[model samples]
Target: MPPLDSVLAGFADAFTLFNLLFVVAGVAMGQLVGAIPGIGPVMAMAIAIPFTFTLDTLPAVSFLVGIMKGGLFGGAIPAVLINTPGTPDAAATTFDGHPLAAKGKPLKATKMALYSSVTGDAFSDMVLILASAPIAVIALKLGPVEVCALMIFAFAVIAGLVGDSLIKGLIAALLGLLLATVQLDPEQATPRFDFGYFQLYDGVNLVAVAVGMLAVAEIVRRMAEHDGRPQPAAVPQSEEPGARGVSWREYWGCRWTMLRGALIGTGLGALPGLGSTAAAFMSYASAKRGDPGGVPFGEGNLRGIAATESANSAVMGANLIPLLGIGIPGSVSAALLISAFVIHGIQPGPLMFRTQPELVYGIFGAMLMANLCNLIVGQLSLRAWSAAVKAPASFIFPAALIFCIAGVYLSSGGLFGVSIMLIAAAVSLTLTAVGIPVIVLLITFFLGRRFETSLSQALTILDGDPRALTAHPVALILLVGALATGVWMARRR
Candidate 1:
């Protein structure tokens, strides 16, 4: 544990005026963006990264974290009101949320989502704080061989969990690995896939690739599918007295469901690459299984709303566990956060606690603060977000496209960056048009370089001896586990 003074200093750092402003701004933006269909927290974070390049570390990260936290709950607003999930994680919420809205209780459903979201978020944040240090301690003991095995295990797990088709998921992951091999060789300085383009010598710009695939590609897809129609009004019962609020009895009745969902979310999120969408659905399923005949699930059940919202929102904080403890991002949002950390000269891993304890604890403090900010801002901006969701898709996508381009150009510093972004966006769109899972590709791309570096180091330590693996039981076990999981997933398919 960090000393009392260090912890206090960290909280003090996160409590600064600059950090607070960014947090509030980020929450507001997240709520707005998330309330609009076809826009999500990942897209918002990708676009926001460029603007953060000029800010100090704490404020920049606080801003992004605030967005992620707020977006979790914000997504449920559209799900409840219009039956359109603003983010993938909120899809399960639509099951009961829209039904509640149909019954003229949209505000009650929205408030249930809000309260449950904050509860789960706070639960996961506390778990993150309690678990991160111990996990980091164990992670620090891992050798290069063990690290390599762990990476392989993560790859196998992600490939299995991401998509329905195992073959497609594996293909996507392999393609990401191939793309990551571009630029100079890790061992020697010789360039590998530059194609004689001088600009490729430094490899693909992380910001450009990330923004293109996540933000620009989505924008392009939405634009390609655009109809000249405004989205339906979100709040169907905006003026109905019966839909005004949720009572304490209604909220407390689903406490067990909320707690179960939070636990499910936190557990799944700590594993690398199993995302919030999965958590939400899993929690919803569990709730349905446990429900003892009350309003019926999928037919305006408050418990169903509580379950899905809590689980999905809980994932936002829990996903950071792997990132902070083992230096592996569990989702696209965490990957963007890792990029932000790198941009600020901070490296996340076991040593981060020792080398930058203040910064790490400051981030913890900021996360807690962001949850509070998310609740307050989400409540106050409910009407504004409902109004904003009515904006035409034609207007939103074009503006988003412009923002994506500008953000890439500004962050990467020229036409070269813009070109890279455009190329990446094209490729991402092409991949998505097929049966491929672009999310798996993006996650693998983020982790590939680290896997490669660890593999190289492990091989060097082994001195080219194949028998050396027998000396490390942990690595052998992890590799075997990975192989077994892969085979099982293949058979299940």
Candidate 2:
């Protein structure tokens, strides 16, 4: 554990006026973007990275974390009001949220989602605070061989958990690995797949790829789906006589569901690459199964909203566990954070805590502060978001497209980077249309370089002897676990 003084200093750093202002700005921006259908927190973070290049580490990171937390709740706004999920994680929210909205209780549904989101986010933030250091300690003891094995295990788990077809997930992951091979070899200066392009020497730009696939591609997909017809105005309707905010008794009734969802989110978030969308769906399913006789789910049940929102929101915090603990980003959002950390000259993982305890704790404090800000700013801006959602998609998507292009250009600094982004966007759109899971591709891409580096180091240390893996019990165990999981998934399939 960090010493008491270090923790206090971290909090003091995080509470500075500059950091606080960025936090609020980030949350407000996140809320606005998330309420607009087809834009998400990941896209917002990727786009915002260029703007943060000139800022200090604490303010920049706090701003991004604020966006992440605020977007979690903001996604529910459109899900409840327009039957359109602003983010993929909010899809489960639409099941009950839109129904309740149809019943003239949009405010009630939105509030339930907001309260549940804040509760879950706070719970996960506390868990992250208490657990990250201990996990980092364990990680610090692991050798390169163990880390390689751990990456393999993570790959198996991600492939098995993400898509309906394990084969498709593996294919997507392998494609990511292939893309990761485009730059110079780690051990040698020779390029592999640069194809005579000097820009490929650094491999694909992470920010460009992320913005292209996650934001720009989604925009293209939505534009393709859009007809020339205007969208109906999303006017707020009057609530029924009893359809005000959630009653305290009703809130208390679903407490267990929220707890379970938070736990699920935390567990999954700590694991690499199994994202919040899966957690939300799993929590919703579990809630449905556990309370088969309760108020019918998908029929305006508040517990359904509570389960989905809590789990997804909790993931926003808990997804940092692997990133902070082991230097491995567990999701796209965490990957963006890793980029931010790197740009700020702070390496993540166990050594980060030892060398930068104040900064680490400052980030923790910032996360906690963001949660409070999410709750406060979420409420105050509810009416504004509700009104903004009424704007035409045509206006919104064009602006989003311009932002995507400008963000990619600013971050990468050339037409070559913009070209790569456009190509990635096209590929992403194609993959999505073909039913391939783009998330699997993105997560694997994020992890691919780390996996290769660790594996290469492990092999060099072992002198090309495969049996050397047995010398490390942790590595052996993880490989065995990966095998067992593979077998189980195959049988299940």
- Backbone clash count, each prediction separately: 0, 0
- Could you tell me the lDDT of residue 53 within candidate 2? 73
Query: Relative to the unseen true structure, what is the Cα RMSD of model 2?
Result: 2.1
Reference-based lDDT, residue 112, model 2: 94
Tens digits of per-residue lDDT, candidate 1, 135-198, equal: 8989999999999998888888888878787788899999888888887888898998998888
Per-residue error (Å), model 1, residue 454: 1.2
Each model's RMSD to truth, in Å? Answer: 1.6, 2.1
The lDDT per prediction is: 0.88, 0.86
Please write out the lDDT profile of model 2 over residues 303-357, one tens digit for every residue.
9999999999888788888888887777889878877886677777778888889
Residue 229 lDDT, candidate 2, scale 0-100:
76
Best by lDDT: 1
- Candidate 2: the clashing residue pairs are none
Candidate 2 Cα misplacement greater than 4 A, ranges? 235-242, 290-295
TM-score of each: 0.97, 0.94
